[model samples]
Target: MDLDSLTLAYAYGCRNAGDFAINEGSLALLDRTVPDVDVTAVSRFASESPEYERMVEELDGVEDGALVGGPITYDPESQSRPAQLAALARNGLQYGVDVAGVADDLSVHSALYEGITDADAMLFNGGNAIHYSPSHGNLPYLLAMLYPLQVARRNDVPYGLLPQTTFALEGVARRLVVPLLEDAEFVMTRDAITFDYLSEFGLSTQLINGVDTAFLNGTPTAGDPSDGESNRIAAVPRFSTLGDTGELDAAGKRMEDTFLTYLDRLVDAGDEVTLTIQTEIDAAWAERNRDRLDDIGVGYYESYDPDELRAHYAEMDLLVTMRLHAAIFALSVGTPTIGVYRPEWGPKMDGTFRTLDIAEYAIPWDGATVETLEAATADALDEGRALSQHVADNVSLRNEALVSDLRTALSTADGFA
Candidate 1:
């Protein structure tokens, strides 16, 4: 059966520009793989934000007039209900609870309800929101993202998970979600570590090792800075290194100190530096470290739109980021990048850099030093032009492979036709 006969619901919801980049690329991938395929974009928010609308318009491959809405509606005060219901349904199914009843009780948005119920299949796009990170212990938020999958099961519609970096699904989170994952038409991981992590579950579903969809995005044209003579550098901060308690532990302090030292040296070298806050959490961290940044004389840059972020990144001469997406955005725009990330944050940074044949640029937080950052930055700057070409070539190669594999998975799925 051809994909043209299928109507797929693409479920995603995140305010992150990095995730938006992934969604944009995922839409592009789907367009290339199934030119005439029908899709409904289901978000978590009850109403589409202005940024979301802008993203849909800016994306080149998303079909025009595609429906966008959320399936579940809840206020911030009681958003946990859907997750609780999902968990209840998961455990109840083993004891013979009706899937249809559970699904009916959970859905709120009419458009998403109709989209999921009528669609032949469903696909989840964007980055790793499934895992339980210590820094982010909002289980409701994570489980709520899986509500559409539960709805798809109730409707007997097959669903596939696109490539993403998901991990740390332990205890209750694993118990609640494993069945849903096992029931997927297929599951794909963008990193090998996650592929192996999921393999431990011994799922019978088709598990494919696919590349991140972000690579599918075209390289953005570099924009000129207001001061054309300035050597501009940017960095993205993430607070995950603060450890399981989500506070500034020794390791987190060390990571911050090392970064501060790097920034000081950059200032000494006459490079204009700024920190990019990609999400609300990053902003919180920046606020907490206001004194630190103020002392270094570095300011924070904020942008919610992925396209806008890419344009800003294009103006940078170099980027030293703790966030993987920030590095990806910078590299996508031909800005040299170095990733100094926490070691336990899984293999995303390493996997991405290795894929680009620039593994040396990804340094573990524990192993990172001012020296290492400086050296990597110097190397990245020296190789900036070559890295851009390399990124383009790899993006082309990986995107082709991803599309080819996705087609295989879709054609073999239980639905379509």
Candidate 2:
């Protein structure tokens, strides 16, 4: 074998969209070349994240000889909790987990990032910002990233990054991770916006302009336009803990008012709906906008398993999404997704909009109102096949090109460093 081990450090909520994106992408790229190598599944997704622990406990009950399905399994049971466990059982590889059931003494979280520095080759994918961007506050995420990167460097392992977005860099980013990204053997980003951002910061990198890594996700969209006219509008609810809600409220009011007016104009137009987590982080805004989804009785979905979640995007004709993976999934499955962005910080979606030449889909923070979202959405749903075709044409090239690029990249990694 030309290469023996290519390790990865995974960050994000366990089984969340971002985590799923990173994990699946890493696997896809690796399978392109080194099929016989060991793939490590990290036990701790985030510091407080319990995916590792939860899966550990769940493993205790597995009677052995179990099968897990990928997200897109056509099975009805695959869309439920049973599917979650089954998927884990089937697809997950045993890594560092010290949860009570395992006889090993090593703590799961500690073991996840423990040995990467000693590996001959390594990769980091879809990590969340621990470095505390302007929007997110100080946390342990950066520390987690730093410890592993430093270890990899000390061992002189060939290191690479897979489509990560960095922010909240006042301290952690500048001191901890960016330098590693700059000096790593190779660095790649999903869209031009991020590629440019890092380049300005002095990183020697390539712009592969990929979807959110999750675009290749196996989950099939319902792809049914049964509610085409009714699924026209969407609302990205805000739940900022750092910024002023006054701004968010004012913005939300303007957009909702605009959407309602548009709703009145088109007798056949559908309504805009909200999606967000119910917990404290962004709950207030999600709760408020949820009423919009409720009042109109529009089709709505809340936080769901990353695997099971693609159905929502598939169900939509158009999406006004703040979540990057949501839009990635929307575009990949041929549903056009409009990325709602904030200033100076949202390269993930903004870049995708530009790279895909779907600039009309980039809805800026100050510029997009619920009304504008509704108007655009109504048109998309009204012209369902046309919109789907547009997304299909743009994204398929990017997705196909990326798969080829990764294969070429993996083949090249044979002698890298």
Candidate 3:
């Protein structure tokens, strides 16, 4: 039962909030299910700046893992980047970096299949697909950058994708990833467009729509639901992409203007309007949004520990978000969530908003005119409370099932080697 005997690897955009949610979710799941295993986390993408330094530091002590760099840069012409990733992968495998915490019994583990078992239950944890932004190339080390996933597959190791978005493969890139998806144990995207695109490409994947990992346990507001005084909706301003140079401050200003306009139209609309901040790597962005708020809001879970964060989500009456994890946290409390889908990277919208029963709640990223957003918001506010209750009753059970599937995937009895 030594907590430091198991090992694992993850892929993430540490800059994004979803990465934080995924890590914390895995940790919670681990602590509850896995009796005694040391978890190792390695950050894939990083820079030499102080902010980057803070990020890596924040992820401290979570995993007994190593963080290695990749040489394969995303731009197809950046030959050095890919080569570096390949070298890192080879070096890591050669050095047995992934086997750092397998206790004495499973120390020699290195195969794909051979699922483990403890007592009568199978240990369902193994090499997992780092669910993240396909738009962000630096972290993943590019398409087909490493064959470990393939290796894990060959060994019969189960691969579970933690709430990932999608990218439409075109030309040679598309040609390469099809077979990879074909072999994945399970692939769940964050939006419908991604689900549809991957399906169009012939990957018959399940479409179990859910919010970001961050939403696993967000809080709710307590302004007295009995009085109907706090019947309001919440939203995060839209900003940033995995590979964009857009100024978040400017985006914040635009959100402020848009929010005010959105509110003016709802002067007597029964729902109070408010704003919250969801950050990826941009602290400045969250701060900018906070500055623009009406001196009071919920869903601002920054700089808070997981317990406090969960409490914050419990306080919300209704939640709407541009950030994926924000949706998850709200959903964790059975709060109705609206997921925004921008059009430029239409594929990124794959799983988040492509969900059935909630299609009317989705705001098309490219088509978010105030009128449409307001109209949708108005309708959602009317239906939201009941929707939240329904999710708390129905959807929460489905969420538990996903966790069960994950547990089955991570059974830890025998050797994965």
Candidate 4:
């Protein structure tokens, strides 16, 4: 079949710069392997982004559609939590959390629904679209993300997923989503942990081990280093220290204090430090810690454009970030990056670092100290050149494999080649 004749429906929701980077990378991958293809992006907030508008017109004529019949509520004691846990436990989820809000129905945007049903093929772009969260079981979020793909499935249209992170899944949630995943023509996971998680399902789809596509979307630029002076550093902090409840509990307070103390030390050492905000979540955390940040007197860099954000990372001599994509952008451009992460999300960060054989640089936020941060940051700076080359080579190799696999998947999709 002629590639140009293909109408590829790309489903994504941009909530952060990482989301934008993933979308950019998805488009780049398609451009490389399926040039001139007709692409339509399905986003609920299409009106908010020109990039989304350029690919597909703003969403209109949305319909209130119900997929399942049940009560929807946030109360963990509701029948939904236990039922979901029981289902997932049978499928291999050992210990599941019950914080995710329940959703019995989906508000279907007409454009997204029709885009999948009428398109020649569809692909769900990457992120943590399918995952179990400790704070929220993610059932409602999962339904919203899966609604488009479900439409494609019901219409007998072929679909696939790009590289995505998978944290957790269980009972009712697993039962509802796993079948669709198993039936995909192709599915690629962004990390080994996710790949292994999916392996337990014994999916018939061709499962490919892939890296985050955002690594491919970056344009590396080597910045000038400080000549024997304090290094220029950019830190992208997340609200993970506060846990899912968003309350400043004892442990959470300790983590936050350690982080702030580390920053204070950085400032004391005369390093040209700056706070970088890559998402609304990061912005909120900054606001929460406004007084602390002000006392430290560090500068701030904020932007929503993926490429612009990448350029910002490229300019930094060293990047200390809790945001996964911030580290991704910095490493792609050869900047030394130290990832500060919590266990709930650390697996994904560690998986990315492991790809480049730099897992040591991904630090655990729990029991972390100013000394640990200093040690990791110092080590990363010392091995900057080697780390950069390692990342570049690994990303190049993975990107080639991704494109080849995507080409094969597209060629073999039902009613395609």
Candidate 5:
């Protein structure tokens, strides 16, 4: 049997530049590690859409397959009953009549239908969207995300959730997600915390310890050392939201204020600082925070290109970031990073730091202060070289584990040829 001839549908919607980096890095890893398998991606929106075209173009090695509109309706009241029923019928035919029809909107269902029906197996990429988070108010969106996995199972196609962070499932969410996971060929979590959380549900057979796929990215070469006069620092910040309101609550406000104080302290210490923006939300936060910084000379960078982004990280002495991929990008490129953990955002950030053996560098958002940030930043800069070496060694081992498990899963699928 020629496994190289098989087709895989890499299904997940790219949300921002960081996501594009992960998708690109995952493809690069698969090409190097597995090789010769025809791959296609299923996105939630059109690759050419104005909002995501750059992110799609930035994905280096992935080929676009289908644009399934997202699971949740932007305007629920606008959908008609007849149109919904028709979509339900189409979804039934594509996934299987037995899988419960959740997404009754035709646009997304059709795209998912085409992507799943045309592929031999599916790989749900790394992200925290698969599970429910109290911070996010999108139960329908989570259900819509899991329905495709159900589709794969009903059709008896091999499918796996790649290295991702999952939260503790509860209530109806547990009921919907557990069965699909039970039948999955493999389920790898990026951290022991999530693995242990899933273990409590007794899905132990499918669960595996896996590292984030971003570690498979090539390491950044050492660049010119910083002048003794000033150290360059990259900081990424995100807006906090609770419930569905566009307002920041007390906790969210405190976290944002702490981040600003941390950045101000960096500027006060005579360091050259830049705000690294990887998503639209980050851009908005940067713009709003810029006024608060006054003329402190903080630069802003938003790059969809991974190489360009890595170069930005390489020139920095240290990264203090709230975004998971921002830290992943820095560490992958041999730049030291201090992760700002948002417990509200689920376990991905801290889990990833733990996986990389740098949990000490992660500061919790609730009680964070400028002094804590300053100390962590100093430690990271002083031990940058040693930490970089540690990251490189661990990344190699994790990449090998990811590839070995993936290859075994693909080879053992019932109809691979």
Candidate 6:
């Protein structure tokens, strides 16, 4: 089969620089496998936002593309209850209208529906799309994705769910997500946990164990062990509602206290601690904790360029981060990372760490203490070179498997070789 003649609609493309890195890496892999294939990105944001504009810039020269206005607005936490309800109602109505063939060309819904209908194949980008226990407030965001997915299935357009993480699903979300997974031409999960979770759903679709596509971000540049004038450690912070049940906030307070104590230990030890922000949400957290972080003399880094970000990670001797991509960036470049994991953050961190044979470096958020963090940091530094080589080898092996699985999925879908 001539793959150049095929057109693939890539969905869930985002503005987050880390996400862009994954999409860019995935596209590069796809291009190498099947040269000159036409690809169009279907974003989850409207064209007017900076998110969409950034996506356009990143996708420039890749292939032809269109907007298809995203169903959910950014920052759902900030929107009023009535406003959220109205947006949900609007999307629900629009999807119904489009499915009924009553949508006019001028309507955004019509354009979105048409993008899927016109595609020869659909590729959902890698991310945490499944929720294990979504609050009532989170249901709408999950529903927003269903319309496009259902449309693709209804139209008989072959679709694949790329490397993704699934936490827990229940109630309405489980009902909708299970059917969607069942309909996918193939499903590639980033970790064993997610693959096992989806397997329980009894979906007939072929499932493949895959690593994060971001591993294709290229080979790691070895860092010099002797050049360490200062013990540079990159620490990433996250803003989480870990225990917001409208009751006692002890869990939240404990998480913050532990994190600060960990940072304080590093600073007191004469290490040059830097707080790196991966997403806008992380930026907001950093700003809110500015005074606290400032008192400890921690530096800040805020950038959207993945190459620049990876370069920053490369300079660090060790990375202590709550963000998955930050850990990935560090590992990709031979810098050992200590991951902080919380139940609310899902399984990506633990999964990725385990996949790379570095689970010993992971610290559970609730169980974290200054002593534990300090010990982990020391261990990472002592074994840095060995750990780095282990990660590099594992990443290379997984990347090969990922590309192979992708090829098999595409060939199976095309019904030709």
The sequence of per-residue lDDT tens digits that candidate 5 reaches over residues 1-417 is 254322333333334556666666667656865676676665544333443464454455655532333322232223488766665555446434325444544443445544565676677777665677544666755755676677677666667777778875888788888888887777878776787778888773467788777767757444344777788999888765521236777877888878888787788889999988877667767777668866666777887555677778988888888888788777777777888876767788787778778889878887478778888888877776777777666666676887787667556645453
Candidate 5 has a TM-score of: 0.84
List candidate 5 segments past 4 Å from native.
1-15, 46-56, 63-109, 220-225, 242-245, 412-417
Query: Which order, best to worst by TM-score?
Result: 6, 5, 4, 1, 2, 3
> Between the candidate structures 1 and 5, which one is better when assessed by TM-score?
5
Per-residue lDDT of candidate 1, residues 325-413 (tens digit)? 88777766656678877766767888777766778888998789989888887776666567756665665566677899898888887
TM-score of each prediction: 0.80, 0.72, 0.64, 0.80, 0.84, 0.89
Compared with the true structure, the alpha-carbon lDDT of candidate 1 equals 0.70
| Per-residue C-alpha lDDT of model 3 across residues 90-209, encoded as one tens digit per residue | 545532433232333654432211111111121212111323344454334433333344434443444444445556456555555566566554555545556555667666543333
Going through the candidates in the order shown, the clash numbers are 0, 8, 67, 6, 0, 3
Worst 10 residues of 6 by lDDT: 239-248
Worst 10 residues of 5 by lDDT: 66-75
Best by lDDT: 6
Model 3: residues >4 Å from true position, as ranges?
1-7, 11-15, 30-38, 45-160, 188-232, 242-244, 247-257, 263-273, 280-307, 345-350, 353-356, 408-417
The candidate, 5 or 6, that scores higher on TM-score is 6
| Best-to-worst lDDT order | 6, 1, 4, 5, 2, 3
Better of 2 and 4 by lDDT: 4
TM-score for candidate 1, residues paired by index: 0.80
Global lDDT of model 3: 0.47
Most accurate candidate by TM-score: 6
Give the lowest summed-lDDT range of ten residues in model 1.
Answer: 92-101
Cα lDDT tens digits, model 4, 222-305, are: 445657678788998776532234555576567778888998998998888989998877788899889989999788998766
Candidate 2 lDDT by residue in tens digits, 256-293: 56544443443344344435331233345545655654
Pull out the clashing pairs in model 2. 68-86, 130-142, 132-168, 133-168, 190-210, 255-370, 258-371, 259-371
